[model samples]
Target: MIGWREGADRVGDLRGRLLDRVGTGTVDIDRIAGRTLAEGLDAPRAVPDRSHSTMDGYAFAAGDDYPLAVIEADVFPEDDPPELAAGEAVRIATGAPVPDSADAVLKREEAAVEDGRLTGPELDPGTYVYERGSNVAEGERLFEAGERLAPRDALLLGDLGVDEVTVRERLSVGLLATGTEIHEGRSRDLDSPMLANLVSAWGHEPTHEGSVPDDYERVESRIAALAAEHDVVVTTGGTSVGDKDYVVRALDALGEVLFHRVALRPGKPIAVADLPEHDAVAVAVPGKPVGAHAVTTLVARPLFTGESELSTVEATLSTDVGIGPAGFTYAVPVVLEDETATPLGHADSALQVYEETFDPSVLSSSTRATRADGFVLTESGLAAGDAVDVVPYPAVER
Candidate 1:
């Protein structure tokens, strides 16, 4: 098995190769959030276009003495103001375009205007002025290829007069569950629904293709069909070395298995494959619910979102937590409160499943474990008060 970082890197490389297959299209700026840019974008025009006023005051060339002549007309955001002569000022509203000859704005509260004369404290150049191209310069590189757009990015694009953006098309994901108990209706197909929600939240379309038994031929056939229909096929369960674990075998027969497992506890059996024949990718995750969520977000997310970086928050551990193994990196779920993180399944916590050591096997199946606010990835044991970076659920879920 490879390390988790290496697994993420491999999946990111797969995304680059699959970029062309996914293609690109134009989307309205309002709908561009969560989409990856297909090409780098240069600012078509400078933001604000020209120098303006940042406050409702006077505008005039700096380095001039006070008691200047006041312009008769006021400048609002919608109207352009006339040029001002030296020792002259104009009443300007916020966002109003400042005249080319004017640079300083004296606040209305400080200015004394009487008999068309304006007087205020000494002013500096560019004071209270929004300089042209200060926000975004013309021809400046705004976004790079493969950069994912956030909702807040719309504000900048809108200011640049951009109504639409070219972004890579969203990947279509097919969720498949493999287990006799689930296929026969004796057990709930928990992974498919959760996987579907995750794929959608990652800005992709997910279709729950339903479950198939642990039959080798059946698993192979269903995977082949799903691969042909979707850009990605996400299979849950049947990833171990057991006789009933046919997902990995089927993937190997259908395509190239990039890696079979990762050095991650509770999620070690994750697998990624490239289905070249069908022009699709397959990610096989362990059946355990918590493990499935952890592996997919850490490893498979980059394939869909082109993002591998995890946003983390620093917190103090409230309890000592130990790992069972030395080589594996364990994802210990923790509840964050008042800048302190308490391991969810620790004996001191509500679950009370483990004493000092983290039991991933049991915790992976515990639905209560989902209540964790985030998780800490640690290779060694953690002591109380130790500073750790916690990857919040919202960081990966979105």
Candidate 2:
């Protein structure tokens, strides 16, 4: 009786639970990218650490206009400037520390020197001078616990002089694709490679255990081995209640099924389970390519990365898309063009085969997948010109 909405909610809950249970570890700044912090980071001192010049100009005390004597030496960035005495001016370059006695800097273009005397416009206090502690104050919190560090974020931490950070350990995922056809090489194993890419893109390590046949013994044995070796075990195919579906049976024998089915198209037979003996979680995705893609995006993404929601954008539908059942959610592939969502294939179709009606057999058609940018999910049919939420594939950067 689990609907798509409820299933999504459970997946979100599972994300939180897994992070709480998986624990964390310490890593150097170079290796911290894509890792979430286990603890908050507070700056012990301010950035820049001292006052300096922001312009290539001359540093001096500001006051009434004066024909002052310019110092013989020019100040560079690394120089330790001597204190400025009354009516004295020192030539300073950009990023050079301002002398303690100086309160302003005049742009070189604004000032002209003749002989030993420098003449320039009147200056205000603090002009062209970067103040100490302006960028970041001492003891300020930079990042909170559970924040995932991107490459730029990690660089920022390094700029703050942080040598190392404590982060949650990356989960190791095992991918197993099940089906007799796949095992016998009659059908190409597509889901395993796709899932591995997805897992890696989400910042986790994936170990593809390859395909297992529809036999219960093989499925059970593979699940046990994978679960014992990985933090998460993901399987594609054999999740439905059909005669050949052995994933659920194997899961029941080794652990507990948290949820069985979702009220969704293409990916309705998805299943989730937790294996206590192996300290791992198992997820089963439908074998159909589009279904497996949707399920992985909807379930595995949040489960492994701790993301609350899929990144989505609003767009206008270029054509009508027929909804499935009134209560079930539908996933429709579309090519986004200039803010308009063009639904792929013919009208009211969930599965778009090669120039024909949606057939499960054509689910492995790579050409159809390449035609669309991403898929849009909706609970009701969308008419042309209607605004809709489009969930882009992870491949799309934005």
Candidate 3:
């Protein structure tokens, strides 16, 4: 099978697979902030509006107040307040541009204005108002090409008065959850919609969200429908060799199975397939919660993001940790301090995902403080200080 490792084909490698972002469109600037540098259009992006209103306080030239600014109330004569004198304090609102000839802003609260007689403490030396482009430099690189649009970034767009962000189009994703016992979307239950939360976190829109019981025909149809609609398809459960393990079968019917098992811990039995119809790719994650998370973050993440490889780090084990059974990939949660990793106990895949939140697994346990920066695979055993590779959260690497 094509895969990555010593001798296998590098099915999981993404280097050349990343798509060059095409024509850009006007997106709300707020939508593009704080996303990773690797998750954006494959080109440079220019911001729309540079100036924004910051009502906190209006700026003015040094020594240019009509009177003294009272600490609480606003400066009077809203418009054409006065010709800014060298020592005058004009009553300006929080967001109004400061008048020239005044270098300091006396916060209304900082002063006591008596019947328009402005009197306040001597201001600092430099200009007190927020300068234009002070927060964002002119031609500042708010985002390079291939950046993620997150919540914080979205707010920035608002603060900057950015109307639209020229960004790469959204990556199309097909989500298929397979399990006989797991209720389908029709159930409309809380647990059934869990994967949707994780999918949206990374910026991929779910094109086909459905479930298939242990049936090959249903799975096949789901695959066919998704292959036509999306660029990548991700299915949860049914990846193992069990009788209900129909994902491999259904995928093989559509295209070639690149690899069935990976060396990664906690997420073995992961498989990759290429569908020719939609020019899309597919990955099958095992049913176990941990397994499901592993495949999505490690394998599917880069694939959907069009990144050629995953992100990982070098870590030294601080304690002896082993899988319950030998030869199994052992994925452990670790707390990072410098180059050392402190293992979090009870790291089995069975932990509750939502109740507790770890970087890799959802848990209610206090171990949320302890995170799995990444995972390491082992066949024999490891001692404290053993050097290991820790993969970080994955996204499309631009």
Alpha-carbon RMSD of each model: 1.5, 4.0, 9.0
Which tens-of-lDDT digit does each residue in 1-398 have in candidate 2? 57776777787677666666677889988887678788899987887677799899888889735888787878888999887788889999999998888889999989888997888889899899997788889899999887778788766677689989998888899999999999999998878888888888777888988899999999999999999988899999999888999998899899988898887776788899888888888999988887787767775566766664666788898776665456676777777889988777644334345342323234434436646777777777678899888877753221
TM-scores for all predictions: 0.96, 0.82, 0.55
Candidate 1 residue-wise lDDT, 1-398, digit = tens: 89998999999999987877888999999998789899999999987799988888888988878789997889999997898888888889998999999888887888898899988898889899989988889999989998889999999999988999999999889999999999999999888999999998888899999999999999999999999999999999999999899999999999999999999987899999999999999999999999999999998889988788999999999988989979999999999999999999999998888999999999989989999999999999999999999999999988
Worst 10 residues of 3 by lDDT: 42-51
Clashing pairs in 1: none
CA lDDT, every model vs. true structure: 0.92, 0.79, 0.55
lDDT accuracy of residue 374 in candidate 2 = 77
Q: Per model, how many backbone clashes are there?
A: 0, 1, 42
Clashes of 3: 42
